[model samples]
Target: MLAETDIKDRYTSTNKNFWFKNMPTCKDRQFGWESNNKSVLFVNHGKTTLVDSLLKHSGLLGNGPNVCVMDSNELEKERGMTILSKVTSFMYKGNRINIVDTPGHADFGGEVERILSMVDSVVLVTDATEGPMAQTKFVLTKALQRDLNPIVVLNKIDRPTSRPDEVDSELLDLFMGLDATDKQLDYPILYASAKQGWCTKSLADAQEYIKNPPSDSQMGSLLDTILEYVPHPESVGDLDSEPFRMLVTQIEPNSYLGKCYLGKIQSGRVRVGDQIKALKPESGSNNQEVSKITKILLKRGLLTEEIEEGIAGDIVLVSGLKSASINYTLCSPSVTEPLPFVAVDPPTVSMSFGVNDSPLAGREGTQLTSSLIRDRLLKEAETNVALNVVSGNSSESFEVRGRGELQLSILIETMRREGFELSVSPPRVLLHKDSEKNLVEEPVEEAVVDVDAEMAGIVIEKLTKRKGEMKKYLEVADKVRLVFEIPTRGLLGYISELKNDTRGTGALTHSFLRYEEYKGPIEKARKGPLVATGPVGTCTSYALNLIEPRGKLFIRPGEVVYPGMIVGEYNKDSNDLEVNPTKAKQLTNIRTVHKDERVQLTPVQPWTLEEAIAYVNPGEKIEKERRRF
Candidate 1:
C-alpha cells in the first residue's frame, strides 16, 4: 500500500493494481513481486499489439488458469492504440502477478502518468527495429522521474533490421540522459520476439537465434526477469494497520452495479456491506460522502467474479459509491486523514460542441439535441480524468477540453458512432494565469519527428512556420530525428500537413511540456473553405468539376449538401465562395472536343472530423471573415 509520503512522491514526480486470494502456499514472502502491490504496469509508446501478443504468450488469453485479461477498448481496436489503462492478472511461480497495459501513443500520456502511481514497478517496452523511438523516450523519462524501477524489454527482435546491441547502447544513453539513478541505470534488459513468443535474457542466446531460431515457446526469461527485478510493495513499508484508504484511479459503469470505482486499497481492508466514505482532496468543498460497499468484484480473465472482500495492496472494484471520481479517496468512515492525490496535467486543447444546426441536422444521426450531448459529455467527465466538460452560455453548445487533438477526436468519434450529431469548432489552446495572475500561459508540447534524411529540411521548414523551436537534432542512419518545443495551438491541425511534407515516411510524437507565456498567433494552412450555396440538395458531378478547379472539393457527387456546410477549400483570393454544388449543367446536343465532351471531376478529398475541425475557426465565415462566432 502507498503511504502518505509515497503518495506525495507521486504528485511531485509530475504525474500522475490487483490481486487474488488463493490457497497457494500461505507463506509470508518478503521479496516476491506480488508480496505487496502485486501489480506491474506495462508502458510503451505505440506498441499495443505487442501487449496483446504478450498476454497471449503469457497464456492469459485462454482458459489456462490465469486470473484476468485486459480487454482492449472498442476505440482501441479501431485506432490500433490503447485508450484506457487496463488491468489483468496471471500466476507465475505461485505469485499472483497483476499486469496493467497502458496506451503507447504520446496523446495518452496523461493516462500513463496517472496509472504509474498504481503499480510498484514498470515494464518499459521498446521497439527492436526503431531503437528508442520518440514515444519510448517519452514514457521512459516519465517512469524514470517517478523513480519507478523499469525492466527494459527489446520487443520485436525478430525484425530483420533489428540491432539488439545497438538498441541496448541507445537505451543506456537514454537512461543516463534522463539522469536515472545508479540502480535504475543498472536495469535488466531482455530480448524477445513477442510475436514469436520467445524471450532470452542473454545477449549471446539472442544472437544464436539468427542461425538456429529458438522454438516458439514460453517467455520464461522475461517473466523471471520481472519477478527478479521488480521490488515488492512491502519494501515501501506495511500500511495494513492504518485506516482504510484507496485512491480512485479509474471509474466504470456496470449494468448491474451502476458506477464501479476501480482502485488499489492503500491501507486497511474492505468487504461487502462495509461502511465507507468518500474522502476528497483538501481543495474540494465537499470533502466527504457517506457510502456503503454494496458489492465487491474481482477480475478473472474475461469474466469478473463477485468477491466478498479485498484487503490492503489488492486492486478491487467497489460498487454503490455514488459521485466518486478519479483522484478521490475511498476510506473507512472512522478515518479522517485524506490520502494524497496526484493532480493530472491540465487539458491543453478545447473546442465547442454544439447541437447540429445545419441543414442536415438530425438527418444522419438520431441524437442531435443539446440535452443529449450535454448528458453524454457529463457522463464522460465522470469517468475520464483527461476530459473536462463545461456548459456553454447558450443551451445549444458545450465546451469540451482535453489533453490533445487526438484525445478530443476520439471522444467525438465515439459520439459519432453512437448516433450523435454535433457541430464542432476548431480546437484552441486552453490558457491559464500564472501565480502572479498577470501573465497568461498556454500549453506547450515537446514534439519529436523522425523522417527520411532527404525530407528533413522540408519538415523543419513546416514546423518552423508553425512557431516550433528546435531543441535537438540527430542523424540516425539514413533518417534524421528532430525535437522541438511548440505550442499546442500550432499542433492541432499540423499532423495532416506533416504527413504530407514527409511523404508518409515520418513518425511524429509529442508529450505535454510545461505551460509558458503565450506564443503569437499561428496562421492557418488553408485560406478559407468553399461554403455551399444550398437549398438542401445532393451535389452534382457537373458542378463539382467546375468547383474543384476553384479549390479542393470535400463532398462526393451524390452526397447531401446543406447551407453553411463546408464543401471545399478556398484557394482563390476571395474570402469565401457561396457556390451552388447542386447546380446542374444544361443538356448538350453534341459532343465535340475530346476533353470537353466528358466532365471528369477530380477525386474528392473528404475532410476527416479532425481535419475539418482544424480547418475552421470559431464562427468565421469564409466570405464575411470580420465576424467571430
Candidate 2:
C-alpha cells in the first residue's frame, strides 16, 4: 500500500512549474511505493484537445502546435486529433506513472481496444457541455468489458455554458445504461479546465481556482488520484516468480532499430540479453522463432530511455525482433504457452486500391507501379492490425478493408503523402451471410446526432430516405439528440450533407452495431460526373465560366486536364456530360468598343480524402496525384 501524505505538503509554490519540476527525487521516496503504474486517458470523437492540454500542463509536452504530443503524425497534427495510441511517462511524488493517450475517433477504436488491456485504470475525459457522446459510450463499454474502473474527468468545465451538475447526472445514467457494476457506478469525478491547467475534486473548487489564480499547479490532484485508486502491476501476481511474457500490442519501424514491438510485460522480467521467442496464439501452429532482445526502451516524458530490464506491468519497447507483429506473444524461450490476446472488431468497409492508370499517373509521383503499392500496403498491414489487404479481381488492384471510411481514407491519404499514386474506388460495406436464417445481411451502425431542434426534421427525413430507422429521439434545451440504426452504405456520403443541412453546428458520430437483415435498396439519385472530352490542355477561366451553369466545377483555371478525366459534377441532369474545360477562348484581332466580360467562376469546393472516396460511384475512381483527389 502507498502512504497517505498531505497533498499540499507534497506540492510546492516555489515555481509555477512545480507540477513536474518539483517532483521528489528517487532517494527521498519510500521503498515499497516506487513501482510504476499505468493509466490511459481517452475521449470521444474530436475531444483530444483536452488530453493535449493536460499533457502540456503536466509538463509532458512542449509548446508548439495545439495538438497532443501523442498525435505525432502530420495528418493528426493538421486535424487536431489523435489517430494512434501513444505512450509517455512522468514522475509524480517519486512514483513513475506511464500514461497512454488513445485516439477518440471510433474509426481508430482498434487502438483503444488493444490499449485498454495494457492499462489498469482509465481516465475518461468528457466535455461538460456535450456530456456523454456516441464514442464515449463505445470506449467506456470497451473499458467496462475489460473490468477496468474509470475515473471521470468533466473537462472543459471553464466553458461559459458548462453545466457540471447536469453532465454529472447524465454520466450516472450512462453508466447505468451500460450496466456498470456497483463498484464502477461509484466513480470519482473531477472538474477540470485542461486549457487553464487546473483540476479539482468539486465544481465549486474548480470554478474558484479559475477566478483566483493559484501559484502552484493543481494537476497534482489528478496524479494523486491515479496513485490512490489505480493498483500496481504486482497486485495481480508475484512478478518476481513468473516467467517472462508479453503480448505485442503495437509495432513501429525505427530507422536505427529496424522494428520495435511495444507491450506491457505480463509476467516476470526481461533484460537486454534475454532470449525470447515470438509465438502466434491465434494461428494454432507450433512454430516459434527465437530472437535475442537488443534493447529495452522506456518512455520518459515523450522520449525513451535505454533500460537494461523491464518488469511486469511496465510498458516498454523491445527491439531486435525481426518478425514480431501485433498480437504476437513474446515470452522466454522456456515458456511454451502464449498469453491470450484481445480480439479486434472485424472491418466493416472495403475499397479497391489499383494502379494509377490515369493519363498523367506517372508524371508527379515516383511510386506509381502496382508492385510498389502492394508492398507498401502489405507493410502497413504488418503494423496496423485493424487493416486487412487482399488481392482484388485484377492483378493490378488490391482490396483493403478497415473499420470505417475514415480509417481507409487516412490510409489512402498517408500513402498519397508518401509519393504513392493509386486509384481508389468508392467505399462499400462488407456484407455477411446469415446461414441459420438464410438471409443476406449488411453492416449496420448506430449513429448519434446532436443538432439544433429546427434541423432535426431535415436530418430525420434525409436519413429515413436512406433506409434508416430511428431508435431514440430527445429534445435537450435548444438542441435535439437523435439516435438511429442505419446501414453503413447509407452513411457513406452523408457526413458532408449533414453538416450542410445543419449549417455546421451539428455533431455526428457512429459506431458499428451488428449485421442485420438487408434493408432493401436505398435510392441513390446522385448526379453524374462531368468528363473532359477535348484534347489535353490547360483549363481556361473563360471555358470554366461558361461551364459553371452546367454543373459544379472541381478544378479552377490553370489546371491540366486530359481526356476521360472527371472535371466536375453534372448538375444540369443525371446523365454524364462531356464538356471541353480546356477550350480556350478564341483570340480574335477584331475588338469591340465594349469592354470584354470578365470571367467569374465559382470557387471550387475541395474534397477531403473521405469525401472523395465517398463521392465516387461504381466504375469510377479517384486519382490521387499531387494531392489532387
The lDDT for every candidate, in the order shown, is: 0.69, 0.76
Which regions of candidate 1 fall more than 4 Å away from where they truly are? 1-46, 62-71, 210-215, 235-242, 283-287, 433-439, 586-598, 620-629
lDDT of 1 by residue, 1-629 (tens): 43434433432342221222332212111111110000001222324444444466555465243322243577665544567777665455655456677766666667776776677677777766667755666677667777788787787777677778887898898889889999998888887765555678876787676557655455778778767877765422344456778888888788888989888776667778889988776745465788889988755444565667676666678997888888888988777766776567678788788877765565567787788999999988877777889987588889888877788878888888788877777777888888786888888887877778889899888888888999888876556878899888877787777767767677777777688998888877676778888588999877888888888777788887777777887888648888999997675666433435567877766456565565677674221111111
**Residue range 53-160, candidate 2, lDDT tens digits:** 556655656645654556788987777667777877655565767777777677887887777768777888877776777677777787788777788888778777
Q: How many residue pairs clash in each candidate?
A: 4, 0
Q: Who wins the lDDT comparison?
A: 2
Which residue window of length 10 is worst by lDDT in model 1? 31-40
